[model samples]
Target: MTMKIVKTLFLKAPPEHVWKFLTEADQLALWFHRGAADLKEGGDWTLVTNTYGKEGEKMCWGKVLEMKKPERLVHTFTHNHLKGVETTCTWTLEAVKGGTILTLVHDGWEKYEDDPFGMAANHDSGWDEHFGRLRRVAS
Candidate 1:
């Protein structure tokens, strides 16, 4: 058992609004963590989560591979604290009943298939917290 990209949805606002929150720098830091990105293809992103344990660490960094407006976004995810692993994270927005359904998926865990439990547990909780934060902010 290994990490299969976790996908979760949050329905609160329109796709355009949700897209703005995801792309904007200030809104992202408000709910998730303080970070910045050039936000273009092959551009870079930096996320510094001081609350992610230890004193202060600019832990996660990645490159933007694709950005398709309110429809989809694909990016590379890397944690400075975690070695030898990289994940491709994608965000897809779809129209739904009351509002937009935002789907966040992190693929590329199959490489660690032998350690399924740890991967599952790690991502399960992480997505819960992060998606919860996104819901609160998107609402």
Candidate 2:
């Protein structure tokens, strides 16, 4: 069975502003990781960091599968810890009364069926921690 992680948060910013945080390397570094995103369909994106483990930097990369500006984005994602497994991440932004409601979904854990739940749990917490930082940055 496939597993997925979904997270949603209300950011005290417009969708356009939140889009910048996700697409621009400098803005992304303030909360997520230092990285560059091509921001077009089929384009490439990479996020690199030294904070997760050991001394050297680790990298996560993917291709932009879809882009709808300040509305939605879908990408294929893979990281070192994923053990060559690839997944997909989708971000949806909705304009609300006070700000933007951001929803994130990461799917395709069936590929890691050997330990699906364990891997999902790890990523759940990781996304939570990162979203907390994103909240602060987007606010």
Q: Tell me the tens digit of each residue's lDDT in model 1 across 16-132.
A: 888877767667776676665536667888776657355346667788889988899888886743465677889999978788977778877765545645665687688788778
Candidate 1 RMSD to the correct structure? 2.7
Q: How far in Å is the alpha carbon of 117 misplaced in model 2?
A: 1.1
- Least well predicted 10-residue stretch by lDDT in candidate 2: 49-58
Tens-digit lDDT track of model 2 for 6-118: 99999999999999888887787888788754366788888877475642354888889999999999998888778888889999999998899999999998897568788
Clash pairs detected, candidate 1: 1-116
Q: Mark the regions of model 1 whose C-alpha exceeds 4 Å error after superposition.
A: 52-56, 112-116
Best by TM-score: 2
Question: How far does residue 121 in candidate 2 sit from its true spot (Å)?
Answer: 0.6
Best by lDDT: 2
Q: Assess each prediction's global lDDT (C-alpha) against the native.
A: 0.74, 0.86
- Tell me how candidate 1 scores on lDDT: 0.74
Q: Any runs in candidate 2 off by more than 4 Å, and if so which?
A: 50-58
How much does each candidate deviate from the true structure in C-alpha RMSD? 2.7, 2.2
